[model samples]
Target: MPGMPKPIRLLSSQLVDQIAAGEVVERPASVAKELIENSLDAGARRIEIDLEQGGVKLLRIRDDGHGIPVEELALALARHATSKIGGLADLEAVASLGFRGEALPSIASVSRLTLTSRAAGAERAWQVRVDGEGRVGEPQPAAHPTGTTVEVRDLFFNVPARRKFLRTEKTELGHLEQVVQRMALVRPDVALRLTHAGRGLLDLPAAADPPGIERRLEALLGAAFLEHALRLDAAAVGLRLHGWLVRPAFSRSQADRQFFFVNGRAVRDRLVTHAVRQAFQDVLHQARHPAYLLYLELPAGLVDVNVHPAKHEVRFREGRQVHDFIFRTLQRRLAEGGLAGTEAEPGAPSPTIDQRPLVGGAPPPAGTPRQAAMPLRLGDERAGYRFSFAAQRPPAARADAAPPPVAEESTAEGGALPPLGLAIGQLSGIYVLAQAEDGLVIVDMHAAHERIGYERLKAAWAAGRVTSQPLLVPVVVAVSAAEVALVETHQALLQGLGLAVDPLGRDRVAVRAIPALLQGADAERLLRDLLADLAVHGDAGRIAAEIDRVLATLACHRAVRAHHRLGLEEMNALLRDMERTARADQCNHGRPTWVRLTQQDLDRLFSRGR
Candidate 1:
């Protein structure tokens, strides 16, 4: 018995592929993601999916896009074979969403996979079938349209371990629905039809604009989300962030609603999650999470696609900038009149510009206090839709000794005003006015200063210039095996931030100095935070970033806040420095530094011709 041939021989290449499929194909949702991506890559404008019993039974996907040629049918089932990547260099800048050539083989290994494709120029179609044993059958002639049709059935029949782990039918179907919803958001131009157990579940046609996309989302996710959603669009910085952020009132108890994508690929990234939470820190309760569908676009090379096995996490070359941009852009948009709803009121007619005077006459002098002469009243009857003051044009300029550092403009009176900058002018004791070259600016003295201080601290850390104060008493931190590895790799960078540490034992470190910015902090909490960051970001580059992020937060707490009064020179100096900084239009965390209102913008508010 001892000399008998070993029963546990090395797994054959085919078996190894099937084993790898265990990680990639968890359930019906996994197959859906890969198959739908194939349809999208084929340039399909219309896609229809039919599934039965959460795809445990028959699953069929039909598309009307340019399909594969007859000759390529057999090669399509081969392992590690794909048109997405060519040579080794393709791995470095993976552009397509489905680059790993494992999807087809993995799916085929678990289910009885059948592929039927017909290229546009070809006269005939071809079909290929792969049984559960990685055996390829002979290709046969088939009758089909000029597109591909993939059918998968009896998933996990060969792999009992996988099939046993599947959840209830309803739960699995819910997960599948989530996959479809995300894909629809990514490709709004494609018409997607989904059917479950012969019952139609979702039918989304191509949308004309972002609003149409939102409407489709409302139909799928719920109309309540749309009521609380805000749209964000910023085209500069070689990136675009367009999606909806739920209002504070509609915050969810769970974070499952926070969806983010890069170049149409959905990802669950901690950097993005942390940034969003930071933006909503003040508004939402600790247990609540803001729901958002943020789409980011940039050159593929700028992002690293090899971060996760599931392809749900990406590393950007400038992740800090991207994170900052998204957080700030959304927060600013939310702050400025709540993103001006595009959906009109149920019955009210749009106002015609026949009586109301046009705004934007002349720039008001800096320091000249002003308010809206006539605020546009909404339809709420209790507020009484009536003008509060006699509208008049503001004079262009006025002479004063020091030139008012703050400025305000009334659009109802035909005055152009820029968005309020960080700098403040003392008005009525609390109100701060901001001055621009062409218009007036107004701001909340307290909130603006707090945000400014927070940004200054963030900038210092990003530049690797955080000042560390030496600790008179050293603290010791004890951790586990993985945490010790993290501490050792990040020792140098941590020291640079004023944390003096030394290995105490196999799984412990003695902290000699702490970040001066975080003086008198809880040593235990700091150590725990360091370990947590290391666990999530398990690479050299991410570790360094984590160190800087920790230092930035500490410095922010020590910086100045807005409510603190400042002299004339101080306000002027702050504005001057802000303008000179790189990305001065936005803060370190990606929020805008200011918003401007021009004369014509005011005229549009009133029923006036400019």
Candidate 2:
């Protein structure tokens, strides 16, 4: 054969596997992933991982599962070869967590790799060594329990360029922990252990039941999740989805805990995330993401898993159908109160929808404040939104609360510093439409109440003059020891807010009295949520936020019920209160309490005189 070009010759199978390693094994965390998957596929019930310097010098995975035979060690290091599947047809219904089969060879090509395995009945264990360049040392006999231990040392030694891109050791280890967590979440039945430099990092026992599984998740994520979550199950188009999603009232700054699994494989698909947010539209604020764990069970033939080398992303045969299902199901679930929706009991008052005020309304009522014509933007990218003259008012230039605190507080100084205008009427029995100096103001009765309650609680607590009412029945709150610690730390703070809770046991607390504001409220449910927040944030400052949150809910419950035909006098008083209230122009949560525009807006819209 004619001599090939040097560059072309160098790009052989050996180099190809090395190149694949770039994507599959980006850092020590990547190596940890490949090794852990091997352990899981072996049917190991208990898996332990130990790392050092982000596994740059040492990465070890020990699992109790069927080990490799001594003779097959060399073939295991060959590129593109794996015991995971036999041929192309096997790819259709892949049940094993680890596929692709290139993980071992890729690592072996770029790092010093060692594998030790012992069959269940074998008396002696065997070890295999593969150095960079895919060279293998002899398989030597050794002693070990039935299982396998795979170690990769000097990761990226053969690829200096890749090593340079690696992050700090702490960062690399954090990634490793993330992989371990994702795996642990899906496989709750498996006992998972992780250590760094001989120090125990995480040790989670196997979960024997669903509750146990959820408890494990709570521990890993946060105990607050236990209460914030609601179970959702939906089946459509031969696809079944079952999981837990956070209530609209409960959210995080980021969407890190959103887990989606197809069949048994964890994957990230944009359609699902988008559908979730769409379902939660208008419920969550723009930057706040909810937490969810969703599992999808459908025919394997419908999905194409060969789209990416890492297999984290997948293509659906019926992508739109899946998207629609996710959207509708989540929307339905959220509508059921997990998000935001109104409900009334039989014989209870039904909400009266106000059409005129919500859409194009008569020009500003005569004798109203002089408002600037401020334009309002609405609508979304998918479903175009429109804004008509709905109660346009003058624009009073002002902002709501200073940049919100990372955590909520019952009392935000100067929160109610200024009033916007007068409350006119409610829209659809939910939004309180009020009039301001420059524009119309809308307030979420619930959010406004919450802000008022928060401020009240903070003042009382700061003054050490909290008013508590003894519950007709004392309440018992079940929480974890960690939460108990949080409560003890904030005992004085909570007491000052008129809540008296004493730790009765390791994972339980006794509630003696609650804040007078919550006299008729669901004390049990409220305390449970409080403990959940404490467990999640682990910060005393979060208590202040919780107080505000509770107050908001209370306000929603206490505020003039939607559908209540307001007397003109009451409406005028509401408007006057809003005008004198700080943040009157906006709701407590930053949503505009009202929006206004002048006659000029109509002129501009009609282009009568530019």
Candidate 3:
């Protein structure tokens, strides 16, 4: 009898509400998120939040949205009571941010809460109070504006275990600020103000115009992000995605700056992340994450937002279609940014180069086996500065070999200068300096050449020009029956990628041939990885990525290296090639290939105005 378990019994309402609180409220940040979402759903254009002790002691939120009538003040604090949805059909196509209606009761169960509101046509405001014991008091007359105000005090005060789990005041406040930031990003049309212990922390006005949006971005994400970011506005197949994507050069070390919202609700979806990562595969470093603030607008019925209690994730009805759309749109936009003489997006102003002095040196003495410093000067005495450097010339081009022929359009003297301009000289045998119509262009020869080569190789591969080499001995791999079926079904697709495989038995496949570029790769391992990718993504992206990786390696090896001296004609040819290549702005390794310094930048460097 002592070891026997207690009889089964129904849990009390207070206990059930507290249990629900565990899922809805993780900390102060969670509370803020839920409350703010409710305010947004109520059509509040301006909301104010005041926190004390990182919202553990007090959280007061005021919103000028449609308020609840006096009759519903008590019902508003009841679990599962909400105006957002009515029945199962409404739940299936939820449009509001807060539909579960558990937030108020769950939060009130953990702390003392006061709710005050005045309906649209109400003559007076009504107030209701709920204690930690889940006791709802009768409504009483109160003084308030024509909206609603929710005040939560002593969070987790009744639950010592949850209270002790809270982090430091500063740490909790930081989390709260991030929640506010996310809200501000998603609802740029809503005004938001946050305060901590009577001190203003964030104040963002509604941004309705382009300039206002840019200013808001600069204030929230910093001037550097706004300067380096590209505008994106793309729509297809009943879906619309618009936002800013930072260039590769401005990629973040962490994913802190990545924000994706679905129907105005911020979420972390695997399908979206995978698509974005694949889009940046060729131009971004593996260790870095692309920074973007993208908002996706689709019909509410097309996505299920009830997957999670916090609604931090969503499941699309057509997952594959959504993934492909996001990938193609971003990839095309990035490629367009590489075009010559064009900014990332049309009508978007080009970013001004930071003011900085250019420092370089003359070549070392001819036939000097050992390197030594040498000084060179540019401009008049007032604007000139001495430069020094030492290095050995790279192999490839001879000093007296004739320069390659240039196109007539490129070399025409009377015509306008090309986007990259005319090559002036080689600097330190590593950079190519050019004179442009409006400024100076400095190109990293090695990096630029690598990108050009990679793009060409990709083009050739895409055109079915990549040859296949039969393996000396067919490599057989044992896999699942499902994988075997997959291999046989996708054989045609595989053959197009220069991969030839035949099913040997129910669970075995033999790889007969592979791409010529991947001749020495481990055939069995490669096939396994390819199969895994196809099974997951249902596409040839895996094989394509593999081929691209090998092609990138070959390009990097054959590209011009540092310390390579080039004739003016050769430099000009290279620049023209860069102008014609896709994704030429960055090398295969995600490094910038060139930079522009306008005449204004030069003036600033020389203190001309001062």
Candidate 4:
């Protein structure tokens, strides 16, 4: 019994390296990610890439950075041999992206690899080679500049099975280009040149300033991104978040435009995704995706960068804190600046306003559209905003809605104009038309009221925790086994959302209680939907979002419906509310609540500006 067979033995260096290659080199994209990261970490301001046959036959990367020294050329290919990290301390707070030093060796073990490098002020450049068997070649003098060149050939040649699993040429190139694109986005100051099969794919110059960076973004992400993007700069505690968030009105059908970097390294972390997704939850529709290029900076010690071999995933020491910070920061930006946040262009024609003289301060003649309207006035711009009663009330009352009448406030001469302008008349019984300082303001009555109502509902709900009612008879919903487990495991989180979910059987959950607001609602369907959201997004962070959806549903029902005729006072009242409501530009569904067309735009449409 004491003599157990020993299976432990030292694996050959080649075999051990091949095993590392298995995890580090999945395909051409994997190879590109590691190589580009190394170039960036070396302080390279410019990088050049060339690939052929989808990088299966050849992959070459050259960088203008401090390269490997002649003496260290051979050592560069050895596993775990790196000048990046010296000890456990350096490992704890890795500042460079290539501290692990596994990329070179792991790649060499799977492909024919060569590295030629010359550090700054070196007498001459040097080159080292490694074959598929992981055998290192002696260093030799090579003609080169103050930079590095790495060439990989015949990827996965040693393992025919792995080579066979690669996708088609176009598919692989797409993945490889995505890798380059992601890296290119992260380092705007770095000039990157990419070529595939001798054809130039991407040529981007280095940007040294913010405007230049914006130009680069426009080129890469497209002009739409710049037109719709809102610059975000916010810091709290020890974390700083700064970048561009596309307006919700410009959400994408797919998530291809979302690029997030943690301390300059591009990452796809769940905590970050969850936080951003949650922030845009209410504003964006279910099928739509928010587009953003967000960058976060914090002390390295608070984050673990070595969690994934590819470095695409990171572990934040304070996950919930980071999540909350990201959510609150982005949420605040969206609230402060509604859709189309930019102001009117400079050097435009001086505004021309029309005024209607009032006799006896009488109410505007019924059914007679007025030529004058009040422009948007400055007020408290925070989320908890409300309009002055004077902006809504008139000298006389309207049966449609009730507000105290005011005689002096009827004319723009009495006070400042409102930001949304004063409503002139309703169009097609749907849109409320208004005249602003420099342009025309068109408001969708239903969408405007829906957002205003939704905000109020949320404010009221936040004032007091959600009210829940116990179901007299528990409603059992049929669900998959996993859903049942979800309800059982997250019982506390569900309870926090005013849902008491208990597993009924192998594939069912009994909802014993639901939020009071959703009492008469379909409890079974809501529970099932909540379970589905949890499965896809994970955790209690999205539970509040579930509550928001229910609120939005209620708000939609109570909001003014299209085709509902309204008096001039009623229209003005809605406009006044929109000027102060949170996220007033868009409804709960992310559809724009209002739109503006400058006077010049109208002139152009009618060829009056020619």
Question: Which one is best on lDDT?
Answer: 3
lDDT of each: 0.65, 0.65, 0.80, 0.78
For candidate 2, the lDDT comes to 0.65
Residues 435-538 of candidate 1 have per-residue lDDT tens digits of 54344545433434444555565556667665666666767777887777778888776766666667777878777776665667676567667668656643
Q: What are the runs in model 1 whose C-alpha is more than 4 Å off?
A: 1-10, 235-237, 307-309, 334-523, 526-610
- Model 4 C-alpha lDDT versus the unseen true structure: 0.78
- In candidate 3, the residue pairs with backbone N, CA or C atoms under 3 Å apart (3 or more residues apart, or in different chains) clash, namely none
Q: Rank order by lDDT, top first?
A: 3, 4, 2, 1
Q: Which lDDT tens digits does candidate 3 get at residues 1-610?
A: 4797989999999999999999999998999999999999989999999999999999999999998999999998999999999999999899999999999999999999999999988899999999789899999999998889999999999999999999999999999999999999888789999999999999999987767777777678776565555566788999988787776755777899899999999999988998999999999999988988888999989999999998898999999989999999888766654342223345333422121211221222222111010011111122111112222233454653423323233333345566667776677778888766667788899999998999888887787665789998999999999999899889888898789899988989999999898889999988988998889888877778888898999999999988766766678779777766777777898877877766766766677877
* After superposition, candidate 4 runs with Cα above 4 Å error: 1-8, 339-417, 474-512, 520-543
Q: Model 4: which residue pairs collide? A: 375-418, 376-418, 376-419, 377-417, 377-418, 377-419
lDDT of 2 by residue, 1-610 (tens): 9887666345677788888887688788778777787888889999999888888988989999988877787777777777777876778766676778788888888889898899877778999898787678999998879999988898888888888998899998988898888888878889999999999999999997665776687678765554445566778889987777665554567778788888877898876676676666545666777778888888877887777787788888887788778878876654443112133233322211111121121223332322221221111121221212223233341222111112222111333211233444456555565544334545555454443443444445566665788887788888888878877888986787678889988998888898775567676676766666455433233344445556556554665654554433445445434433322332334343443433444455557674
Q: Which ten residues in a row have the lowest lDDT in candidate 4?
A: 348-357
lDDT of 2 at 384: 21
lDDT, model 2, position 256 = 80
Alpha carbon lDDT at 469, candidate 1: 61
Task: Provide the lDDT at 215 for model 2.
Answer: 69
